[model samples]
Target: MVTKTEETQLNRLENQVDNGGGGAWEYLCMVRKLKVRRSVKVLKHGLLILNDSKKRSSLGPEEWTLYEQVAVAAMDCQSLEVAKLGGMRFFVLKLMQYVICNLLQDCANALQKKFPESKRVGRLEAMLLEAKGSWGEAEKAYSSLLEDNPFDQVVHKRRVALAKAQGNLTGAIDLLNKYLETFMADHDAWRELAEIYISLQMYKQAAFCYEELILSQPTVPLYHLAYADVLYTLGGIENLLTAKKYYSSTIDLTGGKNTRALFGICLCTSAIAQLSKGRNKEDKDSPDLQSLATAALEKEYKQRASDKLSVFTSGFKSLKVSS
Candidate 1:
C-alpha cells in the first residue's frame, strides 16, 4: 500500500510533470511502482523519451519497456498515427487524444522483430487485434497463446476482456468462473466477477463472490459494503439484519467516513423497523442507530456539501426517516 504521504508526493510530481517541470521519468516510475494509471502523462512523457534517440539510447535495454509502456498508454487514449519504416507505411489508430492502434502495432512489430520468440510480443499482437475490433483474430491469437502456456494469466484475462468487449456477459462470467477455479486467490478477478454478477442481477452469485473477497481481505471495507448491498437487495428479514451488520462493519472500518454505509444503516434500520411493527415485541436494534446515522450524514453534508443539504434531508424525509 502506498502511504498517504507517498501518494501526496506522487500527486505533486504528477502535477510537476503536467506543467513540463521535467520529472516525468521519476513520476512514471513511482506511478508504475504504485500500479496507478496516469496514461495521459505516461503517453506525453513516455513518447518524449522514446521519440528522442539521444535519451532513448541512454536507457539501454529499458528503452524497449518504455516503448511498450508508451504504446499501451497510447492505446488507452485511442490516438492514431502512421508509422513509416523503410518506406512502408502502417496506419496507427488512437482514441480519446492518445496515439493508439497503428503506433501500438509499430511498437509490437519492433519488439517481435527484435525478440521473435517473446510471448509478451505475441500477447501484444493479440491486444492489437482486439483494439482493431478483429474479434475472431484476437480470439484465435489468445487461444494460441493459451495453448502454448495454459498458465498464462494475462492471456486468460485478455480473453475474458475480449468476451466482455463483444458484449458476451454470459461468456465473460463463464470465463471468469473457470479462471477463478485455477487462480482462486486473484482478488481483482473475484471483484470483477462479483460486479458482473451484480450487473446481471445474479445477487446470490454476487453475494458469494463478496463473501470470498471478505474472507480473503477481511479489513477491506469495500467488500463489506458490497456484501451489505447484495444482502439488502436479497431482502428478507434475515438478510436485512445481516445486511445491517455488514453495513455497520463498513462504517466502522471507514471510521464513519463512508456515506453509503451510513445511508445503508438508515435504510436497513427503517426496513427492519417497518417489518417489526405490530409484532407485539420490541425490536432489539436501537432506534437511536438510525438517528445517529442521519446526524452523521447531515454533518458530512454540512461540512463538505452544504448546498446539497436540503436535498439530502428531503430524501430521508421521503424515506420517512427524518424524525
Candidate 2:
C-alpha cells in the first residue's frame, strides 16, 4: 500500500506527463534504473541528460514542472550518486539561492567523502579537497577537468589560485597570462599578475601591469598603493615623488580613514627624507637638497603630530607590530 505522500508524488508525476509530454516520465524511469544498478558512470550520464532536458527551450511549462519533481525524487533516493546528481542539477538551476543551495553543497560534500578517489567527480572533489587544504589534489582535479574542457574559465581561475597558494608563482603567472589573453579587460587578473611579478622580483613588468590596472580603475586605493610599490622598486627619488602623489590621492579618495592611510603617509615621509639625506651627502653645498630636507622634516613632524592626535581622540589602535 502506497503511503499518502508516495501516492501524491506519483499522481503529481503522472499528471505532469499527461498534461504535456511523456519525456519527463521517460527521464525519471532512466534515473530510477541508473540508481538501481548502482552504476556511477551511467548515473553521471543520466544527470547530464536531465540537465540538458531542463535547459532545452522546447521543454514546456509542464516539462519544467516535472523536471523539478524528478529532481526531488532523485534527491530522496538516499544514494550518494543520486544525491550528487540532484545537487548538481539544483546548483545549475538555482545558483543564486545561496542559503538554500547549501543543501546541494552538503550533497556534494557527502558524495566527495564516499567517492574520495574518483576522478570523474571533478568539480565536487576539487571543492572538497580545497576545503581540506589539499591544494595539490585540488589542482589535479581542476587540471583533469580542464583537460576535458579547456575553455572552462572557472576551472582555470581556480587552478591559478591554487598554484599561487601552493607557492608556484611561475605556474600562477603562466595561467594568469593565459587568462588575460582570453579575457583582456579583467582588471583583477591584471592586478593579480602584477602581484605575482612583484613576488618574482620582476619590478619593471610589475610596474607596467599595475599602471594598466590604475588606468582602468583610477579610484581604487590598493591599485595606487601597489603601483607606488612597483615604482619605488625601480626608481629612487623620482619614483618616491610619484608614489607620494598616489598615496595622497588614495588617502583623499578614501576619506582619510583607510586602514593603510597612516602606513602610506609614513612610507612617503620616510622615502622623501631618505632622498633628501642622500642628496645632501652627495653635494654638501647644494641649497636645493637642504631645502628639500627641511621641507621633508617639517612634513614628517606634522604627520606625527596628527597621528598622535588621532590616536588620542578616536582611540585608534595600530595593528600589532610584525617582525
Candidate 3:
C-alpha cells in the first residue's frame, strides 16, 4: 500500500519524466514497485529505453521486468483504444494499424517464448486475448490459469473485469460477491461492488455495502458520505434523520472541510424542516446546528470561491431553511 505522501512523490517524479526532465528508468522502476499504473506515460518512456540496446543491456536482469511492465502497459493502452473504437468491425481493422499495440504484443510473445513456463507471461497472453475481444478464448485461458493456482487474486479480478467489459454487470456482481465470500477483507472489491450498486440506483443494496465498509474501516469518511447519500436517496423522515447523522459524521471525520458533507448537512436540515413543519419547534432540527453549517459553508465559499458566494447564498435563501 503506497501511502498518500509516497504516491504524491511518485506523481511529481512522473511529471518530471513526462516533460523530458530525465529519470525514465528510475520512474518506471518506482511506479512498478508501487503497483501504480500510468500506462500511456510508461509506454512512451518505456519503449524509449527498450529500443535503446545499450541502456537496455545496462539493467541486465532488471531488463526483463521492464519488458513485462511495458508489455502490460501496452496491453492496457490497447484495451482503452479498443473500448474507444466500440464497433467490432472498426476495431478489428484499426487494431492491426495500432503500432504500439502490435509492438507490445511482440514484446509479450518474446517473453513467453523465452519463459514458456512463466505464469506471469501466461497471464499477459490471457490479458491480450481479453483486450482483443476473444471472450471465449480469454475465459478459457483465465480458467486454465486459475486451475493451476486458484488463489491468484489478479486473475480473479481480470475475470470480473471481463464480465464488466462485456456489459454483463450482473455477472460481474455475482462473481464479485462470490469472490468476497472467500476474501471478505478485500477493500477494493467491496468498494467496487458498492459503486456498481450505486450506479444501478440500487441504493438500498448500496447502503448495505457501505455499512459493511464502515464496519470494516470505521475511520474512512468516504464510506460515511456514501452511506449518507444512499440513505438520503431512500428518503423518509427516519432515513433523512439517519442520513443527516452520517453526513455530520462525514463532516467531522473530514475536519469539517468536506464541502459536499457541509452541503449535505444543510440539505438534510432543510428537508427535515419541511417534513416537520407545523410541529412544535422543539420537534424540529437544532437551529444552532443548521446555522453553524450555513455559516461554515458561507465562510468556505467566501475564502475559496468568492464569485460563487452570492450564488450559494441565493440558493440557500431559496430553500428558506427554517430558523
Candidate 4:
C-alpha cells in the first residue's frame, strides 16, 4: 500500500524528473526508494528515455552504461511475478534470461567487428562471459587477451577474479603475486592479495602485505589497523608490543573513536602486563592469560556492545508497548 506521505513524496520526485532537471543518478535513487512495482515502471521509463536515439547522442557515455544496468533491473522485476509460483517453466525463463545476456555479448562483438583491436570491446566480452557464468570461456578470453598484450591491467584483474570465482585460491594468489612482481606499486592488487592471505589464516603473509601498504602510505589509518590486527592475532610478546604501538597510533589517528583500536590497546596492554610478571611465562598453554583475557573481554564489551544492546532493547520494548 502506498501511504499518503510516500505518494506525496513520489509526486514531487516524478515532477522533478519530468521537468528535465534531475540526472540519472537522482532518478535511480528515486526509483530505489519506491516499491519494486513502482521501480519497475520507473526503470522502464528510464530505458525508454535512454533508447531515444535522437536524444541519445546528447547524453554522456555514462548514460549509455546506466541504460544497460536499468534494463537488467527492469527485467528482473518484470520477470518475477510470472516465476513466483515456481515450476520447470521458471528454469526455462532463467535460461531465456541467460540468452538475453548472451545477446549483450553479441552486441559487444558487433561493436568490435569494426574496431577489431579495441581493448574496451575485448574487456566487455570477457566481462559478459563472466556475468553469464561462462567461467571457462571468460578465463580463456582473458588469457588470450593477456597473451596478446601482457601489460593489460584490466584483463589481468578479470583473470585473477575469475580464478577466485572458480574456487582456485592458490591460482589466484599465484597470479596476483606474479602480477605484483611486475607491478609492485599496484596498491589495489596488494590489498586484494592481502585479504586472500588473511582468509587462508596466513597472518604473516597478510602482515607483509600491510607492511608494504603502510610503507607506501603510512598515514592511512586502515592499513595501520590491518597491520596491528594481524600482528595481534599472531600473538607473541614482541608482536603484541608492536601491535600495541600500532593500535595506539590508530587510536591517535582516529581520535580514539575506533572501537577496534580501543579493544586492541586494552587486550595488548593486559597481555603484556601479565607476561611481564614471568609466572609460567614460557608456557604458551598457561591459564595465566585467562583472568586478564576475561577482564579485557568485559572491558571491550563495555566499550560499545552493552551500550548498543541497551539502546536496541529499549527501542524494542517501547515498540512492543506502543503496539
**Which run of 10 residues does model 1 get worst, by summed lDDT?**
85-94
Badly placed stretches (over 4 Å) of model 1 are: 1-6, 79-99, 278-283
Worst 10 contiguous positions by lDDT, candidate 3: 278-287
Candidate 2 C-alpha lDDT tens digits along 6-79: 55665565466546544454545543533333233223333444457444335454443333333333333322
- Decoy 2 TM-score against native: 0.46
Model 3 regions more than 4 Å off: 1-4, 80-97, 278-285
RMSD to true structure for each model, in Å = 5.1, 16.5, 3.4, 10.0
lDDT of 3 by residue, 141-206 (tens): 999999999888999999999999999889989989988998898988988998888888888888
Candidate 2, residue 240: Cα displacement in angstroms equals 1.0
**In terms of lDDT, which candidate is stronger, 3 or 4?**
3
Who is ahead in TM-score, 1 or 4?
1
Estimate every model's Cα lDDT from 0 to 1: 0.85, 0.58, 0.86, 0.70
Please count the clashing residue pairs in each candidate, in the order shown: 14, 0, 0, 0
Candidate 3 has what TM-score?
0.89
By summed lDDT, the worst window of 10 consecutive residues in model 2 runs over: 314-323
Q: Model 3, clash count?
A: 0
Q: What is the TM-score of each candidate against the true structure?
A: 0.89, 0.46, 0.89, 0.67
Clashing pairs in 3: none
